[model samples]
Target: MKLLIVGGTQFLGRAIVTAAVAAGHEVTLFNRGQTGTGLFPDLEKLKGDRSTGDYAALQGRVFDAVIDVCAYYPRAVRELLAAVETKHFTLISTISVYASNEQLGQDESAELHTLTDPNTEEITGETYGGLKVLCEQAAIEMLPGNVLIVRSGLIMGANDHTQRFPYWTQRIARGGRVIVPPALDDAIQMIDARDEAEWVIAKV
Candidate 1:
């Protein structure tokens, strides 16, 4: 299958590219070419910037499937889908879209956070989750029943630029008692970046 990936140079995005290549799929990448630029030297990498809404690199491109990993606003998603053609569209959304975390075992039926200012392009802690909800809606609007939304939880694994998981892992490896979070009883949910990437390619 031919696949196109948006932002295929970082974290989960890099994992997706790796998984797709291993699975024998032809892949093309569309990103700003500013990060992990040295990686994936053998694949086709298009140059574009979503921050500025520049999708010229993808104009006339078509793929069997497309996985968008960097869509943070509804406008970006709408413009991106309009720029390319694909049989299936996969959006790498987040669990943050859920309005309430108090309820246990909530599924996709759970209510999503409402965006007070859908027109706002500013992405902050307060508006991030709501914006993602809107982005998901935009994808559905653009592709209808052919869209797949993966509301993934905190993604953690190799190639993580945040250095978050590595910090804790290295600290614990130092062999000394450490300060632990007070909420030990709280249930933690997360997915390995590689695992999620593999699952996405399999679906494609």
Candidate 2:
């Protein structure tokens, strides 16, 4: 299968590209060509910026599936959908879209947060979750039954620029007293980048 990955230089995105290549799929990446610029030297890498909606490189391209890993706003998703032609669209959403975390075992049916002003595009701690909810909704409405929304929890693996998991791992490896948060029995959920990437490619 031929796949087009948006932002295939970062953590999860890089994992997706690696998995796709290993699975014997033809892959093309569309990103700004900033970070990890020369990683995938063999595969095709097109230069474009989603912030300015400059998808000129993908103007006449088509793919079997598109994995959008950097869609934060509804407008950006809509613009990408309009620019590309693909049968399946996999949107990388987050569990943050949930309205509240008070309830246990929240699934996809759980209520999602909504912004008071839908037109507001300024992303902050307060509006990030609600904005993601809107972005998910936009993808679903635009793609109808052809969309797959993966609401991921904490993602941890190699090439993680945030160094979230690595921070704790290295700290604990120092072999000294470590400070842990309250509730040691708290259920933690995390998905490996390679695992997520493999699952996505299998679906494709």
Candidate 3:
């Protein structure tokens, strides 16, 4: 299978690319050529800015599957769909789209956040979940049954830029007065980047 990956040079995206290549699938990366420019010297890379909605590098391109790991807003999703032709689209979404935190064992059918102003593009802590929800909705609307929305929780592994989980691990290793957050009973859903990548490849 041929794959076009958006934001394919960082963290989870890089992991997905690695898995795809290891599985003997043809892969192409489309990004602004900023991060990990020299990481994948052999794979095809396209230069363009998604924020500006510029996909000139992807003109007249088609793929078996398009994996969008960087899409965050509805307009960007639409712009991507308009730029490419593909049989399948996989959107990397977040579990934060759930509307209720009080519910335990929440499944895919759980309520998701929705934007009051559909035109809003600013992504803040207040709007991130709703923006992801909008992006998922847009992908579903565009691809219908061909869209795969993977709502992941905490993703941790090598090449993690956020350092969210690594900070705690390093702090614990330092053997100092590491301040641990309260709420030991709170549910934590963590998935390794490699594991997530494998799952996505299988689904795709």
Taking the tens digit of each residue's C-alpha lDDT, what string does model 2 give over 1-204? 989999999899999999999999999999999999879999999888888989899898899999999888899889888898899899998888999978889988899899899988889887888988888888888889999888888999989999989999999999889999989998888999999999988887
Candidate 3 per-residue C-alpha lDDT over 129-181 given as tens digits, one digit per residue, 9 for 90 to 100:
99999999999999999999999988999899999989988989989687776
Q: Each prediction's Cα lDDT score?
A: 0.92, 0.90, 0.92
**Worst window of 10 by summed lDDT in candidate 2:** 119-128
C-alpha lDDT (0 to 100) for residue 48 of candidate 1: 91
> In what order do the candidates fall by lDDT, top score first?
3, 1, 2
Per-residue error for 132 in candidate 1, Å, reads 0.6
Q: Which segments of candidate 2 are over 4 A away from where they belong? A: none
Return the TM-score for candidate 1, rounded to 2 decimals.
0.96
TM-score of each: 0.96, 0.95, 0.96
- Of the two candidates 1 and 3, the one with more favorable TM-score, higher being better, is 3
- RMSD per candidate (Å) reads 1.2, 1.2, 1.1
Candidate 1 lDDT, 1-204, residue by residue in tens = 989999989899999999999999999999999999999899999999888889998999999999999999999999999999998999999988999868889899999998777899898988988999999999999999999999998889988988868888998899889888998797777788999999998887
Model 1 bad stretches (over 4 Å): 175-177
